[model samples]
Structure formats: C-alpha cells, structure tokens
Target chain A: MKEAAGRRRQSAAASPCAACKLLRRRCVQGCVFAPHFPAEEPRKFACVHKVFGASNVSKLLQEMAEQHRGDAVRSLVFEADARVRDPVYGCVALISSLHRQIQSLQAQLALSQAHILHLRMRRTAAAHLASGDHITSASASSLSLEVDQTARFY
Target chain B: MKEAAGRRRQSAAASPCAACKLLRRRCVQGCVFAPHFPAEEPRKFACVHKVFGASNVSKLLQEMAEQHRGDAVRSLVFEADARVRDPVYGCVALISSLHRQIQSLQAQLALSQAHILHLRMRRTAAAHLASGDHITSASASSLSLEVDQTARFY
Candidate 1:
C-alpha cells in the first residue's frame, strides 16, 4: 500500500493533468481533473478552459462524485468546444438543424406514400378491366383499400 | 443619466436575482446571473448552481459578452437540467435519441420507396395486358422502368 501511494504521488509530480499543466499549477495525487483531462490531450483542456475557466472547471469537478466526474467533464468539454466555435447558438444549433432535416424527410415520406396509393389504385382498376370484369374507378378504389396491407418499413 | 442609474440600482436592491436569492449572497448592480435567471424562474439558477456551482457560473458569465451571456446561460441551464435528470448522459442522451429517430425514419422512407416502385411495375404490366396488347411480363417490366418517373416526396 505504501509503495502504490508513493508511486501515485511520484506520477502526479512528474506529469500533471492537462488542466494543471496549462494553468501552471501542481497536480497533486487524487486530482479531480487528472482522470478526465489526461496530459496528452492538451487541446481538450485548452478549449474547455478557454470557454469555461480552469478554476471554475476544477471547482465543478471537485463538487461532483468521482464516478460521475468523468462523464460530467466530458459533457462540459463538448459544450465548451461548441461554445468556442459558435459564440451564440452552440450545440443547440446542431439540434435545430437535425430537427429541420427530420421535418423535410417526413414531408417527403408523406408524399411518397400518397403517390404509392395512387399507383396501387390505378393498377387495381387495370386488373379488373384485364379480367373481363367491368367496374367503376370508385369500386376499384374501395377494393384496393380492402386488400392493400400496410408496408412494414424495414 | 444619474436618474436612470439610480433607478437601476433601486431595482437591483428591490429584487436580487434568483442565484443571489438561493445562495444568500449579495447581488450587485452588474450581477451576471440577474438577466438570465430572473426572479420568477428561480429553478433555472437552482439547477445550474447545483450542477456547476454558483461561483463558477458567475465567473463564466462575467467572462462572456453582455449580449451573449443570456444565450450561454440558457445553454448551461438546459444542460444542467438534463444532467440533474440523468447524472451520467445529460443532454448527450437527447442528442443520441434524436439520432436513432433519424436513422429509423430513413429506413422507413427507403422501404416505402421500394414498395412504391413494385406497385408501379405491377400496375404498368396490368395496363399493357388490358389494352389488348400481348406482351410478356419481362417487356412490361422494362416499360415500367422506362415510364415510371421518380415520385416527388414533398
């Protein structure tokens, strides 16, 4: 136990976390930022520190539980990066853009469905005429509604 | 100018911002939390403070531009609320859920288009047969490929 603790302390003294390195501070053992912001990924901490100050992030991490801090830090880094890129909208802009795509796709799907129904109705009418049976377009349409099964979109 | 400043000072004194109210701290004239976390919406600041800490959030807002601080706070509040609900995933869960919906919708759309093409081909073959034309199903299918235009999914 003493050997492990001494090694951990030596490791902290040798290479600090990105947050501590950039902030020019000592990264002691059990650093809150050490697990999430490794020394190698300096850019992650840089952007996050630029958007939300290093001190603030450190404080926030310290407040969170050890298990939850990693995920919380990830979320903060993502939001901070987005904020740095877009001063106003940030990640909300991506959500809105996706919403627009969904709306456009839904409209297209509805139109395709309507056109498919039209084609089916015309085919049903032609089938009736080809079988030597006389039927109005209205009856053919009813027959289509009765026989056509809803498609399972795979 | 002095009158306006006085009134603004009086306003600040009359109603401290939600963050100040909850933290039991003094809200000064240039309190960064006032505009975003209005008195009526104390819950916004409550969640944000709980997640990100009051001091950290205040410092972050102060660093941001006056015009942008409102949007930034809104984004923070939204993420904070999501984090409170789902401690690990936060708003990222919402983004992932939206992505899944988009993929499912795209699959449904492709299936619908394929079904439409099949229906159009069958109808074309039947039409050829009913018009006193003797053509094999193969030729009728080729005719379908030639005559069937792409449906405008609008």
Candidate 2:
C-alpha cells in the first residue's frame, strides 16, 4: 500500500475525465474526490459539478433531455479539457444535440397547434357572420390537402 | 467649449449617472466613450446617459430574469463594493442574484426530471417481473400511482 501510494504520488494516473485529461494535468481524483465539491465548494462550482458528474453521465444526459432541452451539450463540451475524456461526454453531447433537435420539433408542433386553433376561430367567426351557408369558398380555398401528411405525426 | 470642458469636469451635481449621483463621485467614462462611442461632448455624455434612459429598469429586469437561474447574481453582488450605496451597483447585484436563482431552479428541475425517469424505469422493471395476478396488486401501489402522475407530465 505504501509503494502504491508512492507511485500514485509520483505519477497520478491519466484520468479518463475529459476536462482533467484534456488539460494534461493530474487528476485530483474524479468525482469521488469531488465531495469537497457540491457540499463545500462555493456556489458556482458546486451548482455546475452537482448536476454534472464524472461517473453519472447517463443521469446528466437524462436531465438535459428532460429539462434544458439540450443546452447541457454545449456546456459539457466547454467543461471538458485535456485531463477529462470520459467517453460519456461524447455520448451525452450527442444526446443533448438530439434533445435540442427534439425541442425544435416540439416548437414546430406548438406553432402548428396555434395555427389550427386560429383556423377554428376563423371558421367560428365566419359561421357567425353567415346565417345560411355552411361552407364558404374563401375558407375552402385556405384548406390544404397537406393535413393528411401532417396528421401522421399525431 | 474647452473652458466648459475643463471647468465642468464632473461636478457633484452634473455627475454622469444616477449611481454617481448617489455616490457623489465622478463618472469616469468607460469603454462606451471610446472609439465605439461618439466624440462630441453631448454625444459622449449620451452614451452613459443611454444606459439609464427610458425603460432601463425594465431592460435590467429582463436581463436579471435571464440570469436568475444561474450564479451570476452572487458573483455580481460579490463584485460590488459593500462600502458604497450606489443604485447602479445595487441594481446590478440584484439582477445577478435573480439570474443565479433562475439557474439553480433550472438545475433542480432538470434533476427532478432525471429522477422521474429513473423511477419510471425501476417500476417498469418491477412490473415486468411481477407475475400474473400479482401485477394488479403491484400496480395498485403508491409507486405505480406516482408513475401515473408522471405520465400526465410527459
């Protein structure tokens, strides 16, 4: 144990951590040694590292997907340096980007919803205005056969 | 103009900003006065003046809200000199705090989402193993009820 400690002292193993490894520095030991982190480290670093863990990349990705909608990917890339190379960084980065893409799709869905609502509102207004005619030529012209294509997503 | 520039050099009353007004200090013109800023004395004054112009408070509030979920507030407050009672510094500090608070909330929300997913996965595994009629019994439990609640959110 003494000899191993001496070796560890002489040369810290290159931590696979993307941030520490990218910087080519000794790993101050990864998240295990990072208890001084979330509990005691000042608010800024604590908040960042608490959500982002070395061994817990899957959790981080899950959080990114469910909450920030993929903003975490850009942050993860920025967080990585020479000393940190956990392959999970790449996986999570991909996940974050995918999450962002999903969010973009969601935004599109929302706009489409609002548009449909608007069309319904207009139909109601038109019906109020016209006592007899159920189908107006102006409204019929606005209706696109594209509804069949878009409806597949629902 | 030269005499006025020399004589009017920053009176206690004509000081550039509201912060300077309260602090009773000279508004040392910052980067906003240089190459990007206008050269004429009135225009030079306008640069700093613009910052405190119409809707400044609302703009500051918006910026604060954007950063409210992050540590920006604490850091900004820490940067302010406690010795001074300047509104400029106070406003900046307050906005920073708001930003930090927003970030902390965002992080917490993200964590909650990840935890919900984890719980869902756990229940799914448990359900898969629970045989036959026992599945109905397990489904009646609180964990399954929580899953039903979570399902509504997604």
Candidate 3:
C-alpha cells in the first residue's frame, strides 16, 4: 500500500505545467495532488511542480533586479561598460579623480590658514615682548620658570 | 600794517581751547599754541581750522578701527594675544581650530570612500572577465576602431 501511494505522489509532482512554474503562480494540479499524495514520497514529488516559461522568467528577473538595486546597478554599469566600451567609463573615471583633487586642495587650504594663525600668534607674542607694557603675567611666569629650570641644571 | 596783520594771525592760532577754535569763538586772552600753527597768516579764519580735541581724536580712532576691521583682526591675531584676559577672543580661536579639524577629517573621509569605490570597481571588472560571455566580432571591431591613441598608450 505504501509503494502504491509513493508512485501516485511522484506522478502528481511531475504534472505541474511549465507556464505555472515560470509565472511563479500556484499550480492547481500540484495543490490537488498534495492532499492525496503520501508523506513517504520524496519532497520534490509531494505535489506537481511549477514550470518557468520565458515570459515568466523575464518578469521574475525584473522583479529580482528591482529587489537587488545595488546588484542591478553594478550589472548595468558592467553592461554599458561592455557596450559603449571605454569612452563613457573613462569620462566618469576622470571626473571622479578631479573631484578628489578638489577635496584635497580645499583641505590643504584649511591647514595652511591654521598654520598662518599659529604664526600670527607667535608674532603677536614677540610684539608684546618688544613693547614696554608688561606681557601677560602667565607667559612671563612660564619664561621665568624655564629659566629657573635651566639655572638649576647649570 | 603787515606786522600788525601777522601778529593778529599768531594770536588767533595760539589758543588752548580746541572748542573755541572750532566754534570760531575767539578768546580775548589766547594761551598756548601747538607747532601745527600756520607760519603765514591767512586773510580770514575759518571754523574748520580749529584744533581737534582728545574727543575728536578718540572718535577718529574709533572710525579708523571700524573701517580697517580686517586689518585690525589680523593685527589683533598677530599682536600679543591676551586670550586669558579676553574670553571672547579665546572662543573665536577655539572655534577656528575646530573648523579646520572638521574640514581635514571630511577630506580624509572622501579620499577613503573614493579609494573603496575604486577597489570595488576593479573587483567587479575581474568578475566580469571571469564570467565567459559571447563577444561578437562586430563589437570587437568597433571597439578596436574607436579606441583612442591616449587609451592605447596609457
């Protein structure tokens, strides 16, 4: 009895139409057989399987492409790269490189301005010293302390 | 008559009160004179010839300081910076430093992202080559024909 039931299940699973499989639509044949087919049958033969038609494959591919946007973009880039060849690719590459150079230049400018400020501060300190007016006490104290340390070492 | 006229001019400028000079308000007993007094006597005295007071000097200084704002800022920065004495000055300095650091970090991040994208593109290129695809003779011919001299050398 178990052998006969397994044979029935195998026939049902193989019976699903190719159109239903490609469309990713449910197979009524597969669904009808699932209830009567014995558990002893292989899982693939538990019901009739859906077949993928060309149109259904195209639709599924589009949906999958939509889902994996990043991968789709990467593949499209690869395709254009293959088709138009290197002209468009080279232009994109050049633009990106120029953008990097601009960023670097801006960063360098900021760094140079900071250095200029530092130099200005040093000049100010020197001018303050040159003027008869007492330079700020803390700076004077620090200078004196450095001198004392040197004197101790001497 | 010429000596009398010269004497009268000397008496007009030789006055201590700038207000009286400015007002064209002559003092009967004029006292004190600055070296700025005119060597030759003019036929008529005008209110404009009055010696400016400390108040005027202060106002002129204020106006000068306001006008050369950028110069004043540079001088303040380059001069002995008394930051401990001025909290507002310290805040400006600190803000400038932070802004520089932020700009530098932003540049570094952009550089890093560009590098990553480059690596990813290379990897995708390698994968494309590995996957065997049909390259028709027509497409290959076009690519060879369209290939520029720069690309060939590079």
Candidate 4:
C-alpha cells in the first residue's frame, strides 16, 4: 500500500492533471480535480475552469459524495462547453430544441390519427356498399370518424 | 446616469444583493450579482455560490454581454438549484426525461402510421370487392399492408 501510494504521488507530481496543467500547478495526491479532469483532455478542464474557477470546482467536488462526483463533473463539463459555444442560451437552448422536436412529433401523430380515422370511415362505407347497400359517393364521404374503439385499434 | 448610479449604490449598500448578503459582504456599486440574484431571492445565489463560488459566477456573468447576462444568470441559477436537489444528475436528469418522452411519442407515431397503412389496405380490398371482383372473406381480410405511400398518407 505504501509503495503504491508513493508511486501515485510521484506520478501525480510528474504528470499533473488537466486542471493543474491549465493553472500551471503540480497535481498533488488525492486531488479532487485529478480523477475527473484527466491530463489527456486538457480542453475539458480549460472550459470548466473558464466557466467555474478551479477553487470553486474543487470545493464542489469535495462537497459531493465520491460516487456522484463523476456525474457532477460530467454535467459541469457539458454545461461549460455549451456556455462557451453559446454565450447566451447554453444548455437551455438544447432543452427548448428538444421540446420543439417533441411538439413536431405530436403534430405528426395527430395527422396520422386523422388519416387513420378517414381511412377507417372509407373502409366501412366500402364494406356496406359491397354488401349490396345503395350508398352514394356523397354519403360515403360523409361517413363519421367515430367507430367502435375495439375494432379501430386492429 | 450618474445620479441613477449613485442611487443604485446607496440602495445596494442598504439592501445588499443575495450573493453579498450570503457572503456577509457589502454589495458594492455595479455588483454583478445584484440584478440577477436579487435580495428577495437569496436562496438562488446561495445555491449558485455553494456549487460555483460567487467570484466564479460573477466572472462568468461579466464575460458575457450585458444583453445576454440575464439569460446566462438564469441558466446558472437553474443549474445550481437542480444540482442541490440532485447531486449526481442535475439538469441532465431533465434532459434524459425529455428524451424518454420523445421516445414514447415516436412509438405512438409509429403505431399510428401502421394503423393508417392497415386501414388503407383494407379500404383498397373493400373497393375491389364492391366493384364485383368476387373476393372472399379470407382474401379481403388478408389484404396486403403495403400500398402506395402517397395514397396511404390520406
């Protein structure tokens, strides 16, 4: 255990994390920023650091439970990257965009429902006509949209 | 403008913004935290500061244009509040929920689409029968689901 700790300390000192590299500081052992902000992805730490300073990020990580720190860091990094790309809207913009997509999909569902109803009505009229019932074109077009719910689903 | 600034300074000193009040510091003239983190809503700034220190929040707001600062502040406040409530997922949870809703909506749309196609095929079979094509019940009931896409739409 002591040997492993010693090696980690030495490695941490030699290869600082992205946060420490950006701030020009040595990454000490058990750094709150080290695990989340790896040295390979320097831009991740840069954006997070620019949005939320290292001191504050450090404090936040220290405050949260170890299990949740990864999720928290991911959320922070995503928000930070969004903030940099869009200074005004950020993550909220994506939320609204998703909302718009949902709205459009709902509209499509409604249209499909109406089309289905019309087709069902036409099929009913065709069945009646084929069964020797005298049905005019005008009457067929005026067939009701409402039908037996059980049969409509099939 | 100078008179207005002076009045703001006096009011700020007396009322001190939420950020300053929480930190037990004076709300100085042109404090970035004043406008968005009003004194009436101290919890807003409290959460934001706890997650991403007041200094970092202030810096983030200052870096953005004055016109966009309000929106940026709103986003920060929402993210901070969500973070406090959900230490792990935060706003990402809401994003995932929206995605789930979209998925369900898509499923509904697909079902409706299939229903429409089935209805169209039944109507085509009924039309052939009504025209005295001598189609039996089994033949009519086993109508092909595939039909002209343009005709299926209606």
Report fnat in order of the candidates: 0.40, 0.00, 0.00, 0.75
* Reference-based lDDT, residue B63, model 3: 46
> Which has the greatest TM-score?
4
Model 1 global lDDT (CA atoms, 0 to 1): 0.76
Encode model 2's per-residue lDDT on A26-132: one tens digit a residue.
54643322222222223423322332333333334433334442333333323332103322231233334555655665555554554454444544554455556
Superposition error at A4 for model 2 (Å): 39
lDDT winner: 4
Give a tens-digit lDDT track for model 1, residues B44-125: 9888877667876777777768988878787888877886787656677787788888898897898788777767666666
Tens-digit lDDT track of model 2 for B46-108: 322332231332233234434331232222222222202332232333334555655655554
Estimate every model's Cα lDDT from 0 to 1. 0.76, 0.39, 0.39, 0.79
For each model, chain A TM-score?
Answer: 0.71, 0.30, 0.32, 0.76
lDDT of 4 by residue, A33-74 (tens): 888888889999999887777887787788878998998899
Candidate 4 yields a Cα-based lDDT of 0.79
List the TM values for chain B, per candidate. Answer: 0.72, 0.32, 0.32, 0.78
TM-score of each: 0.71, 0.21, 0.19, 0.75
Docking class of 3: incorrect
Top-down TM-score ranking: 4, 1, 2, 3
| Deviating ranges (above 4 Å) for candidate 3 | A1-85, A88-92, A99-103, A130-154, B1-154
lDDT of candidate 3 over A45-123, digit per residue (tens): 2111111113322332344433443332233233223213322221233334555765776655555444444444444
The 10 consecutive residues of candidate 4 chain A with the worst lDDT sum are A144-153
